[model samples]
Target: MPVAVGPYGQAQPGCFDRVKMGFMMGFAVGMAAGAMFGTFSCLRIGMRGRELMGGVGKTMMQSGGTFGTFMSIGMGIRC
Candidate 1:
């Protein structure tokens, strides 16, 4: 009687490893694309977007400062 050979095992990463690698690569690509687009938009559109964004950013900063001051004062009252 002839002896039968079993299936050979492959030396490679499993399906999950491939999926994880793909996700990491995709995330890096997305970040690079976002950065490129942001730069392009900033340069091509002149100061319009920058002005609008700056105004909003200033408002947010002022609001945050006011909130922090109020929180500190409230804490001081208790201590």
Candidate 2:
């Protein structure tokens, strides 16, 4: 069974259902993106077995600086 319409005659994604769907979609997209990028990096860098693994780790860790820097800037603007 499924809801045909909400009380307001709107579409029937209830609050919890909407939240769950958002999370599910986000997770799916994230997994697909991660796999695509990981494959690209592995191919693009062209490293040996151990070096390839290390390169991927190093590359992913590098994004933390960019994230932290932007976060601080946002906080600064609010303060």
Candidate 3:
């Protein structure tokens, strides 16, 4: 019997792997966008010093988590 192999002659990635990859990609993109928007908004609102850092960090995490969750779900569905 013949065995199935991926393009590189390796086993194909499983569903979980695909989902994980999707999440990481989404998280990176979301974090970058969040940082940019958060910085601008915080500065506009007169946030300074630690306050600005905290606000930007919070926004980044929230956006990253939201995007990761959705991307993982979408990847899982495709598998």
- Give model 2's TM-score versus the native structure: 0.42
Stronger candidate by lDDT (1 vs 2): 2
Report the C-alpha lDDT of model 3 over 1-79, residue by residue, as the tens digit. Answer: 4545888889877878999999999999889989999999999999999999999999999989898889989999999
lDDT of 1 by residue, 1-79 (tens): 4433456754555444555555455545544554455455555667466675664455445444444455445444543
lDDT of each: 0.51, 0.56, 0.92
lDDT per residue (tens digit) for residues 14-72 in model 2: 55555555545554554455555655788786877887766655554444334444544
In the order shown, the candidates' Cα RMSDs to the true structure are 19.0, 9.3, 2.1
Full candidate order by lDDT, most accurate first: 3, 2, 1
Please report, as a residue range, the 10-residue window in candidate 2 with the lowest summed lDDT: 60-69
Range of the 10 consecutive residues with the lowest summed lDDT in candidate 3: 1-10
Residue 70 lDDT in candidate 1: 53
How much is the lDDT of residue 28 in candidate 2? 52
Stretches of candidate 2 exceeding 4 Å from the true structure: 1-39
Q: Local error of candidate 3 at 45, Å?
A: 0.5
**lDDT agreement of model 2 with the native:** 0.56
Candidate 1 vs candidate 3, lDDT winner: 3
Give all TM-scores, in the order shown: 0.39, 0.42, 0.91
